[model samples]
Target: MHPFALIVSEPIKIDIWSDIACPWCYIGKRNLEGGISSLGDDAPEVEITYHSFELAPDTPVDFEGSEVDFLAKHKGLPAERVHEMLDHVTGVAANAGLDYHFDTLQHTKTLKAHELLHFAKEQGRQLELAERLFRAYFTEGRHVGRIDELVELASEIGLDTGAAREALESGRFAPAVQADIAQAQAYGINGVPFFVIDGKYGVSGAQPREVFARALTQVADEKAA
Candidate 1:
């Protein structure tokens, strides 16, 4: 037995912070799913929660350009280099079963989208809405920042469109989004796709599935001891 082992049994809780506009955040989502899938019957009971983290909180709702131009200008990189980076990330995402269409992507503020996610969380559909928003932005090029579009997306996922519209219009979940951001700041997390396991272990970036699997296994083992 390990000398430092602590013994307790409980479902593992993973709080993930990410944004829809972040390409790696989408990849990280698939990787985490893959990791859980790899555990198969041996996996422990897990509760996964998604938190708000806007990569571009101050971006305009109606950004007037393609994603490539947005990135090139925002990051001060050459257009060619930005394209190259997008191409490489696209390839990686494709390998993870994600289709990224940077050419048609709409670059917009994600604060509203984050608030919508908080609403979905209250309705017990946060992860579903998160996935939908990610796909809407990266693959479908939908304007997730728009209230009408968000209401439509929520309806597609069987969430009450009227409720979602009211919430968005009233800015009900805005504080929840802000709370998540403040928590992230307290943790010193400045990047997207950050995962906190059981409120103790923090894993950053789009780590490999094996990394997640190992962390889960280790946490479970320590708790079981």
Candidate 2:
């Protein structure tokens, strides 16, 4: 055998733009994780960075209505139509092992939640906090828009809640959240759950695990070549 050791390439970077209030974003997250798992032992290492993208920036911090009501008002659709849409997505979420509770969902402004994500990034717990936030908003129907609730969530993920509160209250990470949004606009992305692989390939919507697997494999092959 040769004395030389094998060299491993740098991990592929995946930048994901998503909103906490987006059900599809949560689905996309699970699909992405599934894709990574499908690669098995030979799966190329990947670094994922979550970016902020608010779908309903104009929404009130405390929207006093059901999810269906909020959707009906915001999208100019009837309650029946909104219910249908929610039901379809809820079924889709179930297939992806997500329990979506739209009935109890609090449709509130996610700017504060996004800010908390940025704070988590600085603490090296961005991904953990992202999953927590998604579950909190969609599954548990927790109020992620409030500072106190977000601080509690941060602590759940083993982050420094004190620092998280300070960062959020001071709005220090608001600019970072805005920067991510600006970058998304520059890319002409108008939706959540948008994935940019290696900063070259763009995958929109919550695609199947096979689709993500193929994309990752293709990028790995290209980089290897």
Badly placed stretches (over 4 Å) of model 1 are 1-8
Which lDDT tens digits does candidate 1 get at residues 126-155? 889999999999999899889999999999
User: How does each model score on TM-score?
Assistant: 0.95, 0.97
lDDT of each candidate versus the true structure: 0.92, 0.96
lDDT of 2: 0.96
- The whole-model C-alpha lDDT of candidate 1 against the native structure comes to 0.92
**Model 2 pairs in collision:** none
- Measured over all alpha carbons after superposition, the RMSD of each candidate to the real structure, in angstroms, is 3.9, 1.9
Per-residue error for 145 in candidate 2, Å, reads 0.3
In model 2, where do residues sit more than 4 Å from their true spots?
1-6
Best by lDDT: 2
